[model samples]
Target: MRGSIRFGEFLIFLGALFLFWQYAPWDIFSALDRADLIIAGGIGLLICFLLALVSRWFALDELIHIVALVIGAGLISLSHDVIHTANWSWGDFSFIDCSGGPFSQERDDTYTHALSANAANPNIQVQVLNGRVDVETANRPDYEVRIHTCVRGWDFDHLKEVLDQTYPKPELREDGFSFIQAKPSRGFGMSANVEIILPQSASYKVSIDSSNGRLLLENLSATDLNLSTMNGSITLTHVAAQSVKLHSTNGSLKGQLSAASLAATTTNGGVHLELTPTASGRYDVRTTNGGIELDLATQAIGYAVAADNTNGRIRVNLPQFTTQGQSRNHLSGQTANFAAASIQVSLTVHTTNGSIEIRPQ
Candidate 1:
């Protein structure tokens, strides 16, 4: 969190210092002495520790806090996984698989199955992003697919490259099916990156959460869709549905809407939506560190907007409609003049740390 560039420079400086102490022409230390190696390492660590302590007084403590928070959270998550293993097991040997770095690169035998979208189905769920998940589907689905990155064990850069490759253009297969290498399936590690796609007519409850990848819902007619993310954007575009919900912890939310009833919330993220005049649905948008933009083309029965930003602004634009209602500080009301308009909905918008704009599209 110490600004990546600064951290990189620090690392290079440490490397240069070690090189000078170890191999410089000047006779400083013997290269073959094991005790010298330990002493050198200790000295290097001491330098780093001193620099860390000095940084706390330069308003850089926040950056250190962010880094510590992420590392702590990751360790806690891993611990949770370990504690949930069967029979109080430290780890599950059979189901566990190595994933995400070089060893994950190898491709094994592949298997695939496809079904008709028109066939009878009770539920269909789709998750097309970065986490490992077990997917089950019964509808004809077309998902661009790729195998998880394979980095050799203990090679951080190689492992990072493997993760970067997850976004490659998906490879298609016959019969609306395809397969790719599973991520980090080294011998017996518990990591996966398989995704499922659902048909348009599929009316099943769905939840997709990705930490480092975008979550996009487009041209879908479904009963319900719930999406969440931490470091990626969330988009709901041209979706016509009964119930739609989205949550983004630290990313943007921007998309088009053809639905009448939509609800979304975010933290430290922005929200933007363009609604067509023919679309009249309930809406709820919020953010803690970002702004909100709401454009209502048609008449709406209720309008409630609460925009709060610790370090941001709020801008709302409401055009004159055929009907009018009460208005106050942060709340307003409008007559449902477009009752005959098929979309009966409520409107809720909020934000905390960024700008909120509601303008004409």
Candidate 2:
């Protein structure tokens, strides 16, 4: 989770490692000697560190996790079988963080702000560092956005200092407004939850990028909407957009979405989309470790589907769906009247280690 990892999480990791050491078979890892294990871990660490430094994908915060992992692996592998036989008291595990963390809601202070802009076609861009973004469509024709951010820290002084210094206010632009920002040093324990409200009468170009926060957009129409979160879920409800790109590295994507052109991918999560492809469009969705559930509007448009899954089952249910190729893990077909329909949709969905279910709405 990059910047989202905390000391308490490390405590949990140590606890798990202790449990595994006490119970798990040491012979499974006996295949590798101490020198071999050290060499292998060193090579992996070097490669990962170089990639992390060069790609900018992994931050310094992630380095803490990587180092912890290498240490844990080394420690477990080097430990002898006697460790499992050693008697350990329950008090040794008291360091586990059952309450999440030291920072609590009691130490948090809330702040409210509003940002409004006047534009026929507005562009609303929001970037969160370590919190959440929730955008909704409202009746306000003035293109207004209301923000509620919580500033938190270790104690009262830190909370007050951060709250006084930071407020999520939009910066006006020639096109519209941008709420993008870098994470503050004092924002370590903060929750920069930004709630955006878009006008129903106007179309927007919205872009939101969060490093470690959940994203939610509902009942919003956009000409172009881009959303990406590194470690949180992305949810869309009754969203209609001309172009939408959703990417989440560690979270699921589930909801009702109507996009003319869509490309959504998640590395470690599932995707369940109820799509209303009202017109000609191309949709692509991919996930690595999760299942995919796609429900299309049966009568609204014609669809040419190509869906695939590895280590999972595939099912396609549609009225008058012509099957070109059908197998346990692959399905390619089209609607009955592929050419006669006014609107046609081309969908490509793929997943690994999960099932694929495409059915008619």
Candidate 3:
């Protein structure tokens, strides 16, 4: 977010210059007419620059010099053709058509390239420098080689070239999936993202470590799944696993563990787990510093269930499970008999400082 003081000062100076030019408008027919625009622009730039000096001299204390520098940079970006463009289309239209038609063609060009390449090889992974990755492996073949990537800048061709050079062999394996590594000189941030897709029937696994960026998993059917993030959120959709573990620090973790045993934990954060009634699976749910939710369905069977937390509430949802409590310890009682059942499932839930809710589906 741009600082308020810098924008305010720039707007004030621009307004003052606009009023001055209005009161004593420069004559267009004069010899200095063409030079007048340049002079006016220079004056505006100077004034904007002076705002920084004034702010510093006055020791505004709160507003620093960097803000003024940013304001000056904005002035340079707008000094040419901006006023004329604004004047020509000022009251007629409230919005500028700056959606990258003629002013920006690189965006369209690159997007087209990306679209084509992505369509051709959606399973390919792209790791951006200081940015997140986008993995599209779902419905694609399971990759054998693990890919770790680091990419920087907007040059996709250069990145692709570097990737080609780095992984010259493009190692082919029995499994169609190929792993590539792409890491950036800088790390993940707000603009960073990682997208991973896997074939619905493929037995595979994926783990992500990110900071302040999103991790998206779609249509992944794997035996084991692990996802972790710091100050970021994770969204997993249409994923079925045998065992899944998700953890975050100061970030929300949410997803469906349809056919797998689920465990999650967080510090100074909250967790939400959803098991659809249509979901027939065994779960071991746990958390710390957050609330826990369980969805009970007809297919849920309990051989042994455990929900424990130090400074958090524990709630379990079971239609056919018994409950027992003693002092500060909560115990379970069998509500239904399944002695002959072949499947033995369990739920282990724990927390340090949060609430737990186990409700019927």
Between prediction 1 and prediction 3, the one with superior TM-score is: 1
Question: Which sequence of candidate numbers ranks them by lDDT, best first?
Answer: 2, 1, 3
lDDT of 1 by residue, 1-361 (tens): 5477577655555555444332332212221232344455456555555667878465465445444433333333333322222111121211223322233433322333344555442233334323332333334554333334223333454554554553332334332432323333232222234444544445544556554345556665555666676445666667555567787765677877655567788775677777643344567777776777766555443333343344544455554332233233243433334344455445656555566566656
TM-score of each: 0.52, 0.67, 0.50
lDDT of 2 by residue, 148-239 (tens): 55544335456556555665567755456788654434223344556666657777888998755678788988889899986577889899
- The superposed Cα distance between candidate 2 and the true structure at residue 248, in angstroms, equals 1.5
lDDT of 3 by residue, 45-162 (tens): 5765676666645445334444444444434433422332121112222211111011111110011111222232233323221223334443443432232333222334454454
- Cα lDDT over the full model 1: 0.47
What local lDDT does model 1 show for residue 62?
A: 47
Which candidate has the top score in TM-score? 2
Clashing pairs in 2: none
Report, for every candidate in turn, its global Cα lDDT versus the true structure: 0.47, 0.68, 0.45
User: What C-alpha lDDT, on a 0 to 100 scale, does residue 345 get in candidate 3?
Assistant: 55
Model 2 scores a C-alpha lDDT of: 0.68
Model 2 quality (TM-score): 0.67
Give the per-residue Cα lDDT of candidate 2 at 137: 77
